[model samples]
Target: MTSFSAAQRSRVTMLDVAERAGVSKASVSRFIGDDRALLSDAIALRIEQAIDALGYRPNQMARGLKRGRTRLIGMLVADIRNPYSIAVMHGVETACRQHGYNLVVCNTDRDDEQERQHLAALRAYNIEGLIVNTLGHHLEQLLELQREMPLVLVDRKVDALHSDLVGLDNPLAVRMALEHLEQQGYRDILLVSEVADGTSSRVERLHSFQSQVSLRKDLRGAIQETGPDLHTRLQAFLAQDGAGPKALFCANGIAALACTKALRELGCRLFEDIGLIALDDLDWYPLVGSGITALAQPTQAIGTSAFDCLLKRLRGDTSPTRSLDFAPQLLIRGSTQPL
Candidate 1:
């Protein structure tokens, strides 16, 4: 009796399948490989039987090395803590799984250096594409990456990079807030933002508020820009008698919460001392003293659109780079009206 070495017994190859099935090695190889054109039904059945009998599992790493395409996508989000980012990621992950692709996620914490490092790591993995929820600071680096791989921008866009973008209509969202407030007889409105430099969403919201207020002479001078220390500054502004804007329009959920805390500390009564309206309907909006009124962006729609845009790019549909903007819906609550 002859004894087979441990290495020989452990190894499983196409030749073994061919020997078991009584067919050529080339026939087994063609059947197991992705190229279906080279396989016939009878040979394919025999190859499948041989594979099951031998318990053969092909080496995915070797297959990837040979094909040079890994069917993986990299998703870079500015902040994973933000609810909006998580919603968008849900859409991306769902789309990837449906198409036999896998996603690798990286959170940049809105840091430029971190963004660059993540991009490098994703490249090393040879990701088939990218879905970027950007910080809007790394324009040159992102533009260069776009030239090398297909990328879709979500929520925020880099100015220099011509890529598909999916986000809420910022100007319209702000307009909705303003209109709701106006109808409720609150004319002295203030628009508060965290960053002084202003993002696309912030700038667009401010501009829209100003444009709409300009038409009505009774409206206050203009919307106020609160500094980074919004809570403290807002409290100080409200302390002075008739000094600050009577109504507040928060740019997003973050600023809205800060404003809420300031109001609570100041012992301010909702719709009596001041009116409040915010963008992005938050989870805690309804739980507040009086529910906060807001212009709600369609979070699911934004995510789904982004995923669809990425899929189109991957399918070689090189149509014009598109921007898909979802309209905002106003949720009326006690915050914007008198008790």
Candidate 2:
């Protein structure tokens, strides 16, 4: 019996397959790359038989690199802890797998320095495209990367960088929430949001709230940011005399959780003392007081659209930049019941 080293026994190479198949390495290459039709049927069969007998497998990454394509998409999220990001990520990953691609996700945790670092690391990885759901603080790095590959922005817009955008219609979503609250007989409204921090979505939602409130003479509105002062602000909003009944419009799930915590700490009753409606319907919403009313964004759709945009660009799409704004669906729950 012949003896073989462990490494030799474990490793199977295309060259070995070619030798066994009695063919040139070039013929093997063409066969492995799905160009088998270029060869004679006998040659194809021999290559196939050899491949099966040798248990040969191609290194996809190595092959992709040689062809200047990685089939890898990179996603940069501002805060991975946010439920909204997680939902969007799930959508993107699903689409990637369905399309025979892979996803690389980076979480910046809402830090500017971390965002910069992650961007550089993604570039170094030679990702074929990027999906960003972060405040675009490092413009130079982002612009450089955009020049090299397809870039898509999700839930936020970066100035000076023209690219495809996927997100909810902020103005429409705000209107939906406000209209629902008004119909539910809540006259005083406080829009609670995470500090804008230059996030376009937050700013857009805040602006929409201001403009929409002004148009409704019957409604009184205010804005509050989530922070250590959140509980105190909630107390004041609940205690102060307002238009009629008061309600808090949380801009997103994170804001909804923060505002809920503050309201609870202030010893305020659920919808009885105050009403609540939030953007981004979360799983635990129903478990809370009267099930929090919500303006639910099509998060999965947004994510899938983001990847599709990248795919188009990767496939030589040179069309003009697109802005896809999905509408929100309102879920009426006990929290929004007439007080």
Candidate 3:
């Protein structure tokens, strides 16, 4: 018998597995891919056993290359530190694994130069699709990438690209929160959001709050930016007299954190002196003063749906782009329910 070296013995190809399984290369490929449903139980079983016996690990990148595909997805995030972004990224990762694909994520940290760099890097790697969560400042780069591959936007709307979008229905979510606050005897409302810096979600939430509050004669609503000015603005809001109790509607998790900090510094009782209802549900929401009432955005669903949309486009679906707005589930806790 001829002796084979260690390196030679280590390489176990799908063809070797197919030969051992007494199946064709096409059959092995089918078993490896998403079309295993079309295979007979016996054939599938044989392939499985052969794979285990031969220690076969298919090179997905090589396989994709042969088919003119990369099985790689690129994601651009504005702020990777955001809790909402983390949750959504988890969902997208889970979906990609289930579909036999890989994800490459890039964080711009809300910087335009970083955005341009990340976009170029994603293209250099030959990613099959892209899910954008950045500022979309480099339109020419984005348009060029769009022509090369499928693109989907998450939580932000860039008018130039007009790609598929997945995010919350801000108007409906704002209305629901206001309605809940009104029913809880909170007549005065303050909407706290990050500064309007071309971020679509924040702008939409602010617009919705303003539009809805104007229609209700009994409710008076105002907006505040979450940052260095929040503490002073919040103090002013606390001093304002109203017909009923005052409540704060935080636009997102970042705003919630800022508002909570300011309230703590002011030595105001949490959820007792003034109610707080936030848009994105963070894990710490429960631990903070009898839990903050929240409209929990379906972050995982939004992430998974964004990937699904890109998959469709990758598979030759040239249909019109879609904008999916998932509804938030309102979770009422001790904060919103006055004792």
- Give the runs in model 3 whose Cα sits over 4 Å from its true position: 1-63
TM-score of each: 0.80, 0.90, 0.84
Pairs in steric clash, model 3: none
In model 1, the Cα lDDT at residue 15 comes to: 88
Give the worst 10-residue stretch by lDDT in candidate 2.
1-10
Better candidate number, 1 or 3, judged by lDDT: 3
Winner of 1 and 2 under TM-score: 2
Give the poorly placed runs of model 2, Cα more than 4 Å off: 1-12, 20-22, 36-57
Ranking by lDDT: 2, 3, 1
Tens-digit lDDT track of model 2 for 1-339: 345555654598889989999999999999988687899999999999987777677777788899988788999999899999999999999999999889999999989899999999998878999999998989999999999999999999998889999999999999999888898889999999999988999999999999999999999999999999999889888888899999999999999999888888888888898899999999999999779998998999999999999999999999999999999999999998875
Index of the highest-TM-score prediction: 2
Cα lDDT of model 3 by residue, 161-238, tens digit = 979999999999999999999998899999999888989988898898999999999899989888788999999999
lDDT of 1 by residue, 1-339 (tens): 335554655597878989998899888767767775788788788888887777776665566757987888889998898777887798788878888888899999988899889988988887878888866576776677777778888877667778898898877786677667777877677788656353565666777777877876656624455555666766665665552347888888877887888778778886578888888888899898678888888887787677778878878888999999899888899888842
Candidate 1 error regions (>4 Å): 1-62, 196-198, 221-228, 240-245
For candidate 3, which ten residues in a row score worst on lDDT? Answer: 1-10
Q: Is candidate 2 or candidate 3 better by lDDT?
A: 2
